[model samples]
Target: MITTKDLQHLFALIAADIAAHRDHLCELDGAIGDGDHGLAMDAGCEASVKAVAALDPAQATPAAAFNTAAKAFLNAVGASSGPLYATAFMRAGAAVKDRPDLSDEEFLRAFAAMAAGIQERGKAEPGEKTMVDAWKPAADAALDAWASGASLLECFDLAERAARQGCEATRDMTAAKGRASRLGERVIGHIDPGAASAAIIIASIAKFVEQHDSCRIDM
Candidate 1:
């Protein structure tokens, strides 16, 4: 089961990871974007984690934490990623509304919902050299692993792996959406900053699950 505490920890890990990779993400964006992707992601994640952390664990549900994070992220980031990730967290909150904790299945559903929300909000698909390349594959991998009777940790591990691969694959893809789209073939050979950040987010989830031995769920 994943409690609000776990969700809070997850966001904290995400914020830390994003901050640590800020320079790398900015460099990637410099290849095809305005080079502010890292700064936006770092600020948004940091704000989200802080907002969630301020919640009282005794009263905060997982959904509430997600909602709080969503609002903070949106308010902190003025870039396109702001709305996209805010929508993702909102959908994740909706997926487990009213729940104080989440079962493995509920967690998977929320994860998938986040990806779906990102796709819907951004109107981007795989091969678009965008975050969807990472998010969609991570969600799919989680679902597939869960369906195969994997533990929550295993499922998230697979998700992280898929997200990383998707991020790497973006290096070979031409931008088909966002400002990078205007670059045409010039964007190829460089990984998408959005995809890189998405991978970091997914990996944070996996890392949190791994560190917590109680994160397992019955299949």
Candidate 2:
């Protein structure tokens, strides 16, 4: 099982992944949004890393680490995304508060809380072509997998696939929210910046935790 330390490392790996692919994300965003996705993501991830670094991982609760990352993103990222993303983390942290090792139910409930936070804060629904489009499905699938007594790794895999599919779904959708809406028909072919970045963050963290867990099992 992934512990609080793994949670901390997850954000660190996500930060590196975002840094490595910042230009590509910006390029993707340029097709529809303001083309600042890469820059925004980099700023957010850097803030997350600094926040993680500042924490005492051994002492900080899982929720505390998550809250710290969210707060940093809120302060460091100067964009609409920071607040929404922070809300996701805040909700997730609350879901898993004080829990060192999450059971299947805890994991799913935490993800569900994040989805609720997104819905409440963004007020966007499925098919709105927003980050919610990607997040809602992924969270649902993770919840389903967890509810079925699947492993945490399996839950992440399910959510990862759902997220990618959700991101792809955005490709054919006309923009209805965010800067992409300003582009009208021209936005039909590009992925949403928020969805793409969310996918990157989730998938990278999953891979990082999986590798670390495998290493521990092998040992």
On lDDT, the leading prediction is 1
Question: Which pairs of residues collide in model 1?
Answer: none
Residues 1-219 of candidate 1: C-alpha lDDT, one tens digit per residue? 789988888898999999999999999999899999999999999999999999998899999998999999999999999999999999999999999899878988999999999999999989989999999999999998888899888999899999999999999999988899998898889999999999999998888878775534333
The candidate scoring highest on TM-score is 1
Candidate 2: TM-score? Answer: 0.92
> For candidate 1, what is the lDDT?
0.93
Report the C-alpha lDDT of model 2 over 60-152, residue by residue, as the tens digit: 877887788889988888777888878988998999988876654665676678777877898888887787877888888887887788877
- Each candidate: what lDDT? 0.93, 0.81
Query: Stretches of candidate 2 above 4 Å error?
Result: none
Error of 1 at 145 (Å): 1.2
List the candidates' TM-scores in order. Answer: 0.96, 0.92
